[model samples]
Target chain A: MARTLITVPRTAKRDEIIEIRALVQHSMETGYRRSSDGDLLPRDLIRRFTCRFVPRVAANSNAASTAGDLIFAATFHAAIAANPYLSFNLRATTSGTLVFSWEGDNGLAQTETVSLLIA
Target chain B: MQPSTQALQKDDTQNPAMLWVKDGEALWNKPEGAAAKSCASCHGEISRMKSVATRYPAYSSTQRKVINLSQQVNLCRVTQQQASQWPADHESLLGLEAAIAKESRGLPISPPTQRQLADAQKHGEALFNQRVGQVDLSCRDCHETLAGKKLGGNVIPQGHATGYPIYRLEWQSVGSLQRRLRGCMTAVRAEPYTHGAKELIDLEAYLAKRAAGMKLESPGVRP
Candidate 1:
């Protein structure tokens, strides 16, 4: 699994705007540079990141609620430095799960889930 | 350092070097080598090794010489783990060093007071003052005499070794103090000593003494 760090509060007041930070380890090689041996380095990068919110559903509910609402997203480019870090704000309304995903070259896909309680 | 860069280093979430620290934590616990032992088997949790980085470039009785932390680490790999030594400045090695050094973050640098180590430090002091290379400049010339002066677009910093395994912006990666020292030698058109050389270890010893009492900021972000 790709090493990652995510910062989110465990609880927040209703309608409060909370900040969430996410960082992932990646080289994000641009493929432009050449090695000391003179060979071109292959491009490797984290291309996209997204966050989703899924409201808690009652137990025994037969709802196939797979996809969650998109909360934030960004598309990265070659210029992005190694170990990309991003922060965004979320309006807390209800208790739910936050899903974070990173997609990148070299089949790099990682997902992490965090639950936030709204009081 | 720019305020923005300082801000980056201040926030653990923003500092890229933390990634290596995290990886090092994992490596510390995970089993490896013929002995099927992890660092944790002998050292326990990484946090338990706190304040260890402060007294490095220490004298070694077994080797009858002064050694830096990296050399000590490699010695463990060879004698304890029965594993091959990690090549100089290898990513895995850097990760481990960064992780280990992070344990001592905020602690004062405290070089061990051993006769052998003190001798090494004296030797290193001579090296720091000796003029070399086509530039004919000693480390003291710029780091002491010309510190804070602009060289090209950058201001020279007072040479201190309070941080190692720092995340340098120029390299876009975490690097060791030896790497930085080698770069400085190259800048002055001097031939750098080989990694793990006694001269480099002596320099490390002197730097540790020079930076004594200063807080360590391993995995420091430098521009």
Candidate 2:
């Protein structure tokens, strides 16, 4: 499984361009890891990721538990790398915050927060 | 004192934690890679980090979440050591944690106290009791009810923190509370959680509460 380690600036000028990383620890078992019976494990991966910018960016991940604030979200299909890694560059132009999160076949949850400067 | 049970005896012989802890110990002293900043570079001395693991599973206000020792170490690697995470269950990760926990052995296992801790505990307890899958078993079924009974070829300990980040024979490596929980959920055919997650954080609160007052023994050897 890939652990998502996110990094963003502590403070950014309003509308300042910032970079973000979103990754997940996932076996991404493509119907693998079968038992002695040899049954397929079932396909699990980030299918696609949508990066939306509202207050910051709205990300709709096929794996996201919910949709909102999410600056970047993506669904990883079976082909995505194990512990899928995603990164983004966005402009922070408002007093709101930038949200970073990921979704996976296992479960769609795990988030890290970064505050945007209101300058 | 000669080791008693197979669990105890097994540890002295082929302890994965010991193996990883040794690596961690080595990493502590020998600096390598680009910048050549060994962990000891900023930490100074092992003795100085006294009781460090005891306060772990603590809240990281900077990151705005609760994190354990292993996660904290990984964070340092990315931000400070200029390294990346060694796979979720990677030996390097477990070993690094074990080495740190080994240092805190005997220090009290204290849970963190922040405004949100209580809420986290509430969420944790809820999740533990929620029955899932065909077995229709909640974590409480085995851990709370048949806690001491032998199941799946091993005596289920009280799930204490006295020997956390402990080496496990099954894993062939040291493991965190989150790792153990994920395995259990998968066993019951429930959806498992990721390495760093809210469920893990909540469960940390509940388990630490269960093991409160017990000394922390990082890099602990287990069967």
- Each model's lDDT: 0.90, 0.66
| Candidate 1 local Cα displacement, residue A24, angstroms | 1.2
Cα lDDT tens digits for candidate 1, A20-53: 9998878889999899999999999898999999
Q: Give the runs in model 1 whose Cα sits over 4 Å from its true position.
A: A60-64
> Where does the lowest 10-residue lDDT sum fall in candidate 1 chain A?
A58-67
lDDT of 1 by residue, B113-203 (tens): 7999999999999999989899999999999999999999988998898778999988888898899999999999999998988888888
- Per-residue lDDT tens digits for candidate 2, residues A1-119, read 23344556667787678876554444566775686688867776655555543344335524433344546656566644454546678777765455555554556554545555656
Candidate 2 per-residue lDDT, tens place, B1-223, comes to 1154234424422333455566677778766445678789989766666778887777787788777777888877777778766667676777677777777767888777786666777787887788976678888888778888888677776667567676554544457777788888888888887877788878777777767788775656555
Deviation of model 1 at A72, angstroms: 1.2
Model 1 TM-score on a 0 to 1 scale = 0.96
